[model samples]
Target: MGKSLLVLENLSPGRNLDAYMQSVSAIPVLSVEEERELTERLHYQEDLDAARRLVMSHLRFVVHVAKSYSGYGLPLGDLIQEGNVGLMKAVKRFDPTVGVRLVSFAVHWIKAEMHEFILRNWRIVKVATTKAQRKMFFNLRSMKKGLGWMNNDEVEAIAADLGVDAKVVRQMEGRMAASDTAFDAPVSDDDDSAYQAPANYLEDHSADPAHQVEHQNWEEDSQRRLMQAMGELDERSQDILAQRWLSEDKATLHELAAKYQVSAERIRQLEKNAMKKIRVTMEA
Candidate 1:
């Protein structure tokens, strides 16, 4: 089967999309008897020739599914390519005994591959992560009637139909409406437009010298106060506090209790008292 699949690799949709479409369309569609026979040969006998015939016959269906996703701004060739992958997977897992045509079973796999491709390449940041959002992302586009934003009533209607909150519908609409922008503006001869890029005006406050110095001083002061407060406690209390909080591998309450030869509750009490005293000292 591996060698047979490789033979059909050249038939894949490529840069010459029109030619690829024509070629796949030219291949004759299989009859019910022919399809069943090929599927059985591939399924039970592991016949590579039967597998190749099955995949080749299904190429036209893959193209048809990929065309519906043309609005996503992805290359049609790429969409067809992804759909082809799904078709191949469907072929590999297909059971002729299921009493369903291969085309009916393959539709889900075909659309699934194309969906993943769109989500990955649609934007610089992902627009949909959850199951509901993914469903909304595809359906909402078709549900929209015009170029303008959806009105409140339209939003509510679509939300109810899709079984999502109205807010979620609006959120996905916003994501789809947005377009990618370059952080740095393209090089232009016009001076006025050059300063409009995000890189020109957005400030990085972390790099400011005053902020850096203030953050460093605050951290040092906090550390100094913590040390002073801890020093004021008894030696045993200090050891417990250090083991519980300061050590790289901090001791658990039960472990500390075993070492101190006390119950776990006693260790919790000591830890609580130590934290309270530290907080009071730091605040003072």
Candidate 2:
């Protein structure tokens, strides 16, 4: 079974997917007793042959799971291969004493691998990153009521169903609708169309002299206004504000309280009042 299984595993679905599917489909599914025996051998005895047999008997299940993900626009053969990897992992970790069928247990591992593969290759930029976003990415298509963009009601419904924010649902929908555009125009594109590439329009403003001068002026003006506001405060208030905020070593409320011979609560109140005055002055 080991040698034969290895040969079957090497059957590149990319080369001939039909033949590969046929081969996997022909491998007989194990009965409950047979499955348990094989799983026990692999789990307790560390029998490699038993593991191979377990994986072989379940290859058809991997195919069945992979086919459902065909709408992702990835190669079906690659998806099946990924699912096969998951199946092998499931077989390796399966505990026969758990009292569950292998197919039922392996489904999670099978879909996990396929999901990872789809996320990795579906777009040049990843559409989903967080756990919530990943969940929405996979299910958003099915939940959508129409081919067009989802309305507010639909968005709200999907958000409630998926336990995510309505804004997040809209964001995921936008990401899904977006197609990857090359940074640079294709070489075959003529001058009329070449400027349409993101490379042409997404200019770097950081190095622009006029923009730099404007930012510097704004910062200097803000600093001047802040300093003038601080000058308007009494000497003690100025020191408190400076030590608490502008100083390299900031003073805690207790430290400032002790220095000023006031209670910590009094220090906090003074600090709050000072900040409020500063904000009013700055805004004025």
Residue pairs clashing in model 2 are none
Most lDDT-accurate candidate: 2
Off by over 4 Å in 2: 1-7, 207-284
Question: Which clashing pairs does model 1 show?
Answer: none
Which regions in candidate 1 have their CA more than 4 angstroms from the true location?
1-12, 262-269, 280-284
Q: Tens digit of lDDT per residue, candidate 2, span 133-167?
A: 78889899767877799888888888899888999
lDDT of 2 at 215: 99
| Count of clashing residue pairs in every prediction | 0, 0
Per-candidate Cα lDDT values, in order, are: 0.89, 0.90
Give the root-mean-square deviation of each candidate in angstroms: 3.2, 5.1
